[model samples]
Target chain A: MESTANNRVIHVRELVKKFGDFVANDHLNFDVYAGEIFGFLGANGAGKTTAMKILCGLQRPSSGTIEVAGFDVYKQSDQIKKNIGYMSQRFSLYEDLTVKENFQFYGGIYGLSATEIKDRTRQMLESLQMTTSADMILRDIPLGWKQKLAFSVAMVHRPKIVFLDEPTGGVDPITRRQFWEMIYEAASKGVTVFVTTHYMDEAEYCNRISIMVDGRIEALDSPAALKAKYNAATMDEVFIRLARAGVRSMNG
Target chain B: MRIIFYILQKEFRQIFRDKVMLPIIIVIPMIQLFILSYTATFEIKNTRLSIVDQDKSTTSRALISKFSGSSFFTIASYETSYEDGMERIKTGTTDQLLVIGKDTEKKLSRKEEASVLLVTNAINGSAASLMNAYASGIINDFNRFILEDQGPAGAVPALIAVQSRHWYNPKLDYKTFMVPGILVLLVTLIGMFLSGMNIVKEKEKGTIEQINVTPIKKYQFMIGKLLPFWLLALFELMIGLAFARLVFSIPMEGSVVLLLGIASVYLLVVLGLGLLASTVSDTMQQAMFISWFFVVIFILMSGLFTPVESMPAWAQNLNRLNPVAYFIQINRMIMLKGSGFQEVSGLFVALCVYAAAILSIAVKRYKKTA
Candidate 1:
């Protein structure tokens, strides 16, 4: 399906991925517009990671036409890779490296100049209010700061889209809130945020969300629209309603 | 190029920062160099001997005294019977037994060649060979002494004078032979273990995923991963060489450049093995276990503790695939025998081939995508 939105940064249609006999992703179709916080939410093994991996060009789709950041996934994966950034669920940063060192490394790998790396690292540290911890090793820092730092490093190259796979898996409520604030801050700067999360409450923060159940997207709409369509008062109830109905359909 | 530097810097920092790994990389090799160089030897010392003399002759006693006087043999016991001496050999009380037949002295006086039976427990083949040589030398010396005593009244022309000398090692010091091989082990250990675990640690911590998403090409990433350990292994070789020179006084007969040149390529082969191991394993423990198995096998077949020429035919054939074996040969040739580049070119070319093959395989096996 052609994206109806004016600015469709990610247009994935009929995407399918298989691992031998098991289908990890089944005919996933979605349009994520530019400058939007798009939530790809699912439970464990619900294929959120599989689909996100395909989008990020980390896995080849069995069948699909995925155009990410204006580059085809099949023929232009290198281009797609150059235009996107990724943060995995485990908060992928070198524990032995200092925060400034992590920033310099990520920025350097992305082809930033020495001056650019120095400037960006300085700005990132100042923005995170981590100037005092500039030389502190990542393992010594708190988990919340590390999560935020991971995000900041991912966008150091100013890519067209950024993928965050469960950016806030284990953190306190306030830190999670602050982490989402950084996501909002990035999206506000015209960087499309494609995030995956299992947290139902976190799903409410996305501009539009897709709830996956058993390799299929069961619900794709705004949080209000999903609640209204399922006749539920919250995103959590909407998720349960769709997930249960999905299981019933599979069984029937 | 810059990306490679970043990766190299990160790896060096992590390698130096880990408290446990730092000591293991630096201290273990040095300590092993000292300990293994001292302990691993083919020199036969204090070989226990048991004698059973049935003739009760002066000649028999003279032979026994000759053996007993040598520093290599100790007269552990004098059994009354051959069966008792055999029993002593079985019980580990003695390594060898000499049984003198009853007619041994009578035949010698009658101008007939006498016969005596010698028995040895040849559990260790190399040590047994050395023992045989030492015992034979003593018996020959006794034979000459008897010849002079019997025929000195009339002057006789000597038969022949056979001049022999050990060339490279005149003293036949086991330390000289062992120290170079131990240095090869130090390089192999550092090159394989450190490089293997470095890649696997990123994988275990999920940092590899972050690296995979970057624009770092496969070869660039691999070179970045391997370069630090290669240099580090060379640094280790330098230290080990210094220790060999200062402590063991092993001669550095060949050019230092030639040794480092072979060592550099040899390190590539080992570091490539490490990267290949890392690519196949999912965790640091798995990487370590896999590399450890290969390291032990390679070191054993490497002609370090034993000559590769002396191994079984199939094992010698297998050494063609072992990089450590080639390196041990190269190091010993350069340090001990003063072999030049042209002399070791066959091994050098084989190592170059191995380095290329293993590194390319490592690069190909490392999956940037899931």
Candidate 2:
């Protein structure tokens, strides 16, 4: 079979995932294009995380197709791993390590040279304007700084796609704004952003958002268009309207 | 090349950053190795004896002088009479009392035998038995010379006589027997305890997330963790040995290299046990508890104080499972028997099998789990 290079960084078709007869994802389909902020907007237990786990090669899909960054997730998992970065909700980084050390550890894992890590760290610390705290341990830092530092470490390798599983799950608006700025910087560098989040305002920042309902993508489009099409004022309103329609559609 | 160094540097930095747990990594083992080695012994102490002399003759006095001159006892007190010595036995302070009755010298001259009175404190029974044995042995030696007419030449007066010699350590001070085995137990237990828990801590703390997703192979990561601790165990062994040499003046009778060679194999088995433990544990605290539980068993079964043969037959069989047991045998064989590899191969092979089996299982488990 021939492979096509598309603007889509991730292409899924009829993705079925089961957990011992419990269908977590039922025929899920979505496309995340390159250099775009793809918001996985879904309610709790709507299979958004399940689909993301499959995309990240954490869990095997029961049956269906998954193409992440020109690599088949099932067959070319190692290749998929090389071309992407993953950060979990808990912000997986050595807490005992300093900000610079965490950066070095992650960079080393991704096969970057020490010089590259040093230069990149300089750039990251310079952009954050927190050069003085480069050597400050991550556990000692505030949660806001920790969030930003985690994002920086995840993007340290500059992979084609970065998976942020609710990267800012619990943080204030200012910290959330700073986090999105870091995401924006990564996306501007032509890195595709596949992020899962509960915040409606953050969903608005995505170029395209997919609202999952009952293990399927109920709506996938720009927030403005989804809101306008549903005659709703915001993505939250659009989500509620689509969720209701999705229920009624199921009933019908 | 640079990447592995970066990871190594980060790990070392983190190990040092935890200021509280850091010094314990080095100093605790050293202090323990030095202090505890002195405690691991088979030598019995604080024996008490009561003497009653009814025959106040010079010969009786000369015989009593032999007991008081020895270092094994503190002659608790001298009873005025036989009844008093028997009374001293009830309180258990004196494990045994010797009563020499009147006409003790006349009975020997007349070729008629006279029995000595030996009152024993049976409360702490084993000490009483050993004390009686020593007292009887010294009296028997005195009787062989003084009571018999054969004089000094009687032992070798016969034409067909044999001479014997003592080897390795003739004196066989309990400290010489103890030092090597203690070195094995401490090194094996500490290495197993600390190194096994090291990776388990990383796994619990989620530092392993970076390691698992990295291009570094499982074997490399496992080696990097285990090797430093293996070396540390040996370092402690060397330090303990040096202290034993300088302070206790223990003679290394056998080949030091052979002892170390067997010890190195024994260390592999212990380190493998540690790795197996780490593979099973999910937290440092759990690893610590599990290691301590094994250490207790290891010390008991290693024959650090008592002979493995002297234990129950089932316990002797159980001791075969303990790697520390083989190390102790190898240590004593090398240090006391001055034995070669030929004499110690059985223990070395047992340790080899344990090392290979445990290390293989641990590596497989780590790869599958981590």
Candidate 3:
């Protein structure tokens, strides 16, 4: 349980969330270590977003002991916020603002000073090689650039942990590849990355992957180990084997 | 608290960065205050009058002179007959017409009664009634002048004396009543527009999840969200009231600070209702519709346009739930009656209760889908 774990950055135990009578997280338990790309892979409505929401402190668990960055979920949430960055599927950046303005606004909300926002924005824009388009409105930019910019804004405050919910949902394959390169760069700097996606090819990039089905995680292991155990040629086969078996087990 | 300031700074930057919100927040309110204060007045200042003198005699000429000398009526034209005076009224060139009959001198000598005609445009019922009263009173005083010195002791005067005095507003200017009421509407509009769509817009854009993940406490976030609008709403209130004082010449008999203090709570309730509406609506359109619904109801029962006491007893009692009703009472008291805290305490307490209830509903419903 999170109450006992003092080492994990995210410690979720018996994290049950329900909507009316339908359980979204049923006695869920998981822990994420520091500086690892933890992949949360699931089909639609498999509670991946729900579990991520609880970890991020967006939603309260019906009855559970959960902790993020070693702070209790029930209290001391602001401290956790200082250590976290969140980018949801909706691209949590102001579209009307220029790329530079989005960075400044989010940076300011994270308690960065004017100098800090400016300095971080410059370094991040330079790294993205997008210095010339700093003044271009976000809506005018292509989806590929916007996705990358969203990730940079999430990482602006240099939070210890960052959550990306479907961060590369609609980008082209080449852009998605470059997007993972940015994720790798952040991970190499000892920043923990918690990501949710349904992209089977993308799961192999994770240090460890958890495949969830029907409000529960059916399989949690390295992608290679999952493929090997299921005797499958790819992560897609491994996901299908687990998803089908989980559904069968539920009906039986 | 520092974080709240950070959010406010970001919100202001975002507000200014957008093209649509700037005009809605500042420019529109100022324009409304100016136009409403100057135009939406009850005290009739400029009136149009036409005189039809049938006699053209000294007595009729003297009476015509009295009409021209009066401040309320401007001598629009000279009419030779009553039919010509009616033409002036029909053409909309004159608001009112006065007809003096041909036998004015003979009637006074024989001591027989004489008649005068007053025609007013009845479209704007309040202004027309007031103009009619003012014209009749002035004419009656002129008829009494002719009778006091020249007529027989027992002769009946052609006009009746109706000595009247204005109570609160001695000048009876339309601007005096309108200025304070417009101030109430301005504060309500500012409060409703800002808080009404903020949370829902955040949700639609998915920033609610971004904020949710942070250790931002619910009450802390609520205070941060509502306070900017509360202060902004107060700023709007001050602007509207200042315009009322300067442009409309409406005097505040009550303490400004006390009025501001009570008004702040009413702003909170209005803003909280907007936040509560945001919680229920997922889209800007839905939020807008919900906010407008309550706005219409509050304005109808607000007592800014009509007298609350004149409404049915049940309707009057139902008005107690409306924050605008309380605000209207406080505004009129401070701007008109000039009363202090003791006079407005009942409304103040009611607004506080409404604020608490509305804020709680908003906080309880402010949840991201887990």
The most accurate candidate by TM-score is: 1
User: DockQ, in order, for the candidates?
Assistant: 0.75, 0.38, 0.41
Clashes of each: 0, 0, 8
Q: What TM-score against the true chain A does chain A of each candidate get?
A: 0.95, 0.92, 0.94
Instruction: Count clashing residue pairs in model 3.
Output: 8
lDDT of 1 by residue, A1-252 (tens): 234556899999999999998788889999998888999987677788889888888888999889998889888888888999999988789888888888888888888999999998888889889899999999999898899999998899998899999988888899999999999998888889999987889999999999998889988999999988989989988887777755423342
lDDT by residue for model 2 (B284-315), tens: 88778888888888888778866687889899
Provide C-alpha RMSD values for all models, in order: 2.6, 5.3, 5.8
Task: Please state the Cα-based DockQ of model 2 relative to the true two-chain complex.
Answer: 0.38
Residue pairs with backbone atoms closer than 3 Å in model 3 (clashes): A77-B215, A78-B215, B41-B174, B42-B174, B43-B173, B43-B174, B253-B338, B254-B338
The candidate with the higher TM-score, 1 or 3, is 1
Worst ten-residue run, lDDT, model 1 chain A?
A243-252
User: Of the pair 2 and 3, which is ahead by TM-score?
Assistant: 2
Name the candidate that leads on lDDT.
1
User: What lDDT tens digits, residue by residue, belong to model 1 across residues B264-356?
Assistant: 999988998998999899999999999999999998898888778889999989989999888888888899899999999999999999998
Show the lowest summed lDDT stretch of 10 residues, model 2 chain A.
A243-252
Worst window of 10 by summed lDDT in candidate 3 chain B: B153-162
> Each model: TM-score of chain B?
0.93, 0.82, 0.83
Candidate 2: segments with Cα more than 4 A from true spot: A1-5, A11-29, A41-54, A58-65, A209-252, B1-3, B50-69, B77-129, B145-166, B253-265, B311-320, B335-346, B368-370
Q: Rate the local accuracy (lDDT) of all candidates.
A: 0.88, 0.78, 0.82
